[model samples]
Target: MQQITGREAAVAVLNDPRFVVPPVPPGASGIAWLRATVGRFSSGPAHDRRRALAVAVLDAVPPATLRTGGGHPVTVLARALGIAEPVMDLVRDVAQAYQPGTGDESRADAAVDRLVTILGGRHDEPTAALIGVLTQACDATATLIERARHRPVDEVLHADPPVRATRRQAQVATTVGRVTVQAGEVVLVGLAGGPAFGAGPRRCPGWDHALALVAGALARDSPSVHEGTPDTAPGTGRD
Candidate 1:
């Protein structure tokens, strides 16, 4: 495995075509299966299709709505999909599942099952894509909200990013920042000082939605309540 920490080097590796997002191994179960279906884990044509779907779905909901106290973005999205479950509940479940080595497996599985049922049980592309949006946006936005009360949001994101790191696999031999990476080698990109929403074909599709959610939440909450408080946001358990 190769680790890239320098911001410029990390961006170069992330933007290069020779390095690809590592694929989830086959036969993943439970929360893993849901994660595998997300666009971030896909490649080539499948990635393009899922990414378009994600963009279209997210785009349908204006950022202004989030900023104007319209509702939680997840709730809006769930209503758009005709799902009746409480949006924050679902977000909490998915967020817990996404955390590594934390959360109740059985509870997470049940949440996935409930979401799958609500989306008509096939776990099709659209359902998976929407879940991906919620999973990616929910906790991270909440974290940003919690942290921003005491510091600038950008600083919070830089010091404790939503995604601390990402791994890529070299599809072909390539040199990244004077380092030769062999085909099939793994590269871990440290994202603390890297691009905020990633820097390549696999950049997160929910950047706007997340920012809107954070902005809306901040706009609605009193700064006095959150100031100098440690993050006690929901779904922020150890991952």
Candidate 2:
């Protein structure tokens, strides 16, 4: 709602620390969208449009801004920036629900709500893929939630990667690492830098955001769990 120029707003957002992730090592795929959007607003149309674009971009693929690789310095800087990864997962859930092949309207709608709560703003194409990843995790979590609707999660576990992920569609693809599954909640890890699944603090903030977001989703969708009932139901159990 603040009426700042796009260039100014983008610069401000980039510097906000809530968005920008720590820079990863070379040979890693940085967020192309974030770099381009920032470049565009760096010098483009009027300030209002730039501001709107800035807002849209932030609302869209905010996860791109989260720092993933580097070291404690980056993590420390990223956290100081308020640029944690779990928040991005909330954006992702809503984006994925809208995907064409997902085939679950309820899930999509729920994702949209989750996105709204997380971003508290609009959406765009740039953020769509990230959202899709969130949605996938939501779907997988939903699957687990449904299976263990009456159970409690005693422990959180993670599974090592059995195979590498292939790149093709606009989904979160991993090559190295493992998959995380806890009480039917499953996610990919160790791809690129950080399992890229939103687990640890030093890895891809995108995945971290996704994991936190899905955990919330699972709680909401299952009243029993939300109400403090134990999740004793059997689940995937991979961390």
Candidate 3:
């Protein structure tokens, strides 16, 4: 068997439109890459985790803007993952409170309290660990914004030249306006000069790359039990 890196899996998602519209161009090793990335696991718990984490990362946005009040992306993703509504809410609340410019550290505590209350004492360690992971994701978003502070608008959305485009794949990366990477976290800088944070359907240039990035990152970050490590199953555990 060939070794598959998280990045290559991400690239596959970018190139596959059945996964998203206007798929990124299929690369030279498209078939091999696709098989290595998507064929690793049959549909199972692991697959679900991979999907859920993919949604979370690809759909990331500011909490307030992400529509978390009952019927929003958070709820949708939570449902997809089979997690209780309350748990998803708690995660959203905590993330919202901790975000900068939202003001007030007290809110974060409230969010944390709600989470603890929902999970109860026995789940403290697990809750803490989960919270830490979510917090890291939230922080990653912040870091990306900060890094793009000085770059030109066009430069931000620009992809590297010589992208992998296949005859079957739709145009990808050609219409991109900007791109941003903070540490290892990547965010699309839209043509409008706004961070394509949770862009609504019409606004997002296309999420193939973004979704792939999120899926790959979540798969990499998650433990085998949570969302399967990148080199392993890429399962869809509670992540």
Per-candidate Cα lDDT values, in order, are 0.67, 0.30, 0.31
Residue-level lDDT tens digits of model 3 in 132-232: 33433332222222223344323433321111111111233322123221222222211212222222222222133223333333334322221211111
TM-score versus the correct structure, for each prediction: 0.80, 0.25, 0.28
Q: Name the lDDT of candidate 3.
A: 0.31
RMSD to the native, candidate 3? 16.8
Error of 2 at 72 (Å): 31
| Over 4 Å off, model 3 | 1-71, 87-89, 99-102, 123-125, 132-239
Ranking of models by lDDT: 1, 3, 2
Output the number of the TM-score-best candidate: 1
Candidate numbers sorted by TM-score from highest down: 1, 3, 2
Give the Å error, residue 204, model 3. 21
Those runs of model 2 whose alpha carbons end farther than 4 Å from true positions after fitting are 1-100, 104-137, 141-157, 160-204, 210-239
Q: Model 2, range 1-239, lDDT digits (tens) per residue?
A: 11112223323322322322322122111122222222121222432343343344335444433333222222322343354555433333332322223334454455454543344343443333333333333333333334343343211212222111111111222221122212222221122121222222112223343333334434445242122212222211111
| Model 1 lDDT tens row, 1-239 | 56777789878887787877767644244577766776767778887888888887788777666666445556655665456767557666766656434566666777776777776777677877877777666555666667676787788767776566677789998888878889999777776674767777777777776777777777777343223223323222111
What lDDT would candidate 2 get against the real structure?
Answer: 0.30
